[model samples]
Every structure is written in C-alpha cells, then in structure tokens.
Target: MKDKKQLFLSFLMIVVLALMLPMSALGAPGNDAPPDPAYAKWGRIAVQEVKAKYPEDKVVDYLHVGRKTNNQETIETFKLWLEGETKEFGVIIDIHFDTDTEKITNIQFKETSR
Candidate 1:
C-alpha cells in the first residue's frame, strides 16, 4: 500500500510539472497584446522611402516620432537609423497626407545627428 501511494504521488507530480513546462514555453500572458498602431502604415512608407533614397545603406532601426495635424493635412513623422558603408546616420521623415481621404500629399526627409 505504501509503494502504491508513493507511485501515485510521483505520477501526480510529473503531470503537474509537464503542464507547467508548456505554459512557460508559451511565454507570459501579458505578451498577447494588441496589434500595431494606426501610424504603422506611414512608418512602413517612411522606411521604404529611406531605403529607396539610400540604396547603399541598410536600415538598422526605426522610430515613430509623433503626429501633427493642421486644418486639412496630417503629418506622420518617423526617424529611421541607417548603417551605410561609410557610417551610421538617422533620417527624419515626415509623411503629409489628407486628413479625410488619407491620400499622401508630400514626404519630406531630413538627416539628423540625434
């Protein structure tokens, strides 16, 4: 009877450990957050434009600075870091679009040290 009880307890412990292993492998529950933001579209465009302009450079990082709105236009700003053959630099891109229709109006790029 003692051996049987010990074996059952060992099996139960093994089952509990197996379940816990899978949960840990799946990662934390908080990691299941929502998708990208509204500015993701403009961010992609900014990266693409920078890539086109600097074909010799590789885009190493990206950051969405912020957004601004006027009477009829909205500007989505992004900063992209590029690694060129010579050195690394950052480009600030402003994508101006029609607020209502979302049509692109203008895209401006400025190189910056910060």
Candidate 2:
C-alpha cells in the first residue's frame, strides 16, 4: 500500500508539471529553423505569400518559423517584416502571423525599436 501510494503521488506530481508547462514554449516556435532541408517547400511558400501581400516591402528576417500539430490539423507560427521607409513608406515594420491551414492566422507587429 505504501509503495503504491508513493508511486501514485509521483505520477500525480509529474502530471501536474506537464499540465503547467506552457504550450507556446514547447516548440510552437520552430526550434530548428530554417527547418530541415525537407521542409523547404513550406519555407518558400511562406516567404512568397508574405512577399505577395507586401510587394513593396523587403523580408527583414523571420524566426519561430514552424508549426504545431493539433487535433488532426497543423498550426503554423512565424514572424515576417517589411523595410519601413521614413519618407516613402513612413517607418520600418515587422509583423508575425500564425496559420492553421498552413497560411497566416494571427499577426502582430513591431511598433518601436531601441
């Protein structure tokens, strides 16, 4: 009985920790980007999509370029940017996008920089 209780307690503790872990921290961001050579297809598509949307802007850089598997679907998370112009475009800008259908889903931008 004692051994069983201790084992149960240990298992409970592990479960709690696992539950508490943040989903975002767990590779929601691609840990090994520019992913592998195999995922090149997705990479090009990602960049092209962003470029098409912001034709005048340049791809400053991108990170956290990957996705997660959820409920038989995949979620993509990444950041993209545009070269802001003070005179022509106004200011340099960067934005993020999250996609469920292998396209952009949520987006955020860099408002200011130090």
Candidate 3:
C-alpha cells in the first residue's frame, strides 16, 4: 500500500508540473520580437488620407509599394484599395516628409482602375 501511494504521488507531481510549465511559458516576455518598420507611420497616414478623400468608400486593402529617399526628403509610397457602393478602385499615395524633422512635406494621391 505504501508503494502504491508513493507511485500515485509521483504521478500527481508530474501532472502538476506539466500544467505549470505552459502557464510559465505564456507569461514570459516577448522581447525578441522585432519592432515596427519606419514606413509604418507613413502607411497609417496614407490610410487616413484615403479615408478623408473618399468617405463614401470603405478601405478594403493596403500595400506598401516602396520608399525613396533623397538628401533631405523621403517619400513613402502606398497603394490602397477602396470599395464603394458603386465600384471598387485603387489609390496610390505618396507621402513626402523631411528626412531629419519627419515633418510632412507633401502628400500626393493618384487613382487607378487596376
């Protein structure tokens, strides 16, 4: 009877440890994950501008086309797809900002069918 009790206690200890292991892992910090890219800010601006320009349409998709940088300026390009009650279309937005100050220099938008 003593041996059986010892075996049952060992099994119970293992079960408790197994349950705690996952909880500990879940609580651990995720410091190793990468941060957001520099163009993330520009992407958000593009979306907002599109929403303001086409309030009747719903933004269905977004894509970061690319970025171009000169000595004093940087332009972040994005393509956003919008769906309206009548039709769907794409808008390409170019967000130009001062490289050092990160201030908006200009915002240009072009609409496309495809």
Candidate 4:
C-alpha cells in the first residue's frame, strides 16, 4: 500500500512539472526548426519573368538588389544566374510598380553573358 501511494505521488509530481514547462519545451512549432523567409511580391514576379524569358535555362542562383522609390513609382531589382546546356549567364530583372496601386508598371530583363 505504501509503495502504491509513493508511485501515485511521483506520477502526480511529474505531471505538475510538465505543465509548468513552456509550450516550446514540449516540442511545439518553431522550437527546433525555424521558418523560412518569405519572398516579396516583386521577387515572385521577377522570378516568373525570368522563367518565361529563359525557358531553356534553369535559375541557379539569385540576389535581391533592393528596392528604389522615385516619387510615385517603385522598382525592385534582382540578379538571377541561369544555366543552360552549354552556357551560364546572369540576368538583371527590373520590376517597376506603382506605389499607390501596388500594380506592376513594367518588367525588363537584361542578360549578361558569362
């Protein structure tokens, strides 16, 4: 009877201790793994433009060149490296959007031969 009571008390203490711990300590989301950074709207648009223009090539790497604002317009630039069967090239994509409407104004892709 004494052993049974001791076992019951031990189990109760463990439960209390567990409840006092933080939810993350119990293996909640983002505890052991971090979420990936999301792409901006302009970034997605630039990638799609590159894919459409260079269907024969695959994008190997990319770099976001940041955004520039001029009065009522904003431009997002990205440098994307593409690989083809026998050549590798870099493309500079400029995505221009309206600041007030958040709509695309123009997209230009310039290829840099390697």
Instruction: List the pairs of residues colliding in candidate 4.
Output: none
Worst ten-residue run, lDDT, model 1? 25-34
Question: lDDT, candidate 2, residue 63?
Answer: 48
Model 3 quality (TM-score)? 0.72
1-114 per-residue lDDT for model 3 (tens digits): 686467558767877997887677667577343468978988989999999999999886788999999999999999998878777789999999999999999999999997
lDDT of 3 at 52: 99
Candidate 2, residues 1-114, lDDT tens digits: the string is: 686467558767877786766453565765443336644555565567667766777665444556566564454445554454431121222222333344544433332332
Question: Candidate 2 at 91: error in angstroms?
Answer: 14
Model 2's alpha-carbon lDDT is 0.50
Selected candidate, larger lDDT, 3 vs 4: 3
* Clashes by residue pair, model 3: none
Q: Which of 1 and 3 is the better model by TM-score? A: 3
Give Cα-based local distance difference scores for all models. Answer: 0.87, 0.50, 0.88, 0.80
Candidate 4 lands at a TM-score of: 0.66
TM-score of each: 0.71, 0.41, 0.72, 0.66
Model 4 poorest 10 in a row by lDDT: 30-39
Better of 2 and 4 by TM-score: 4
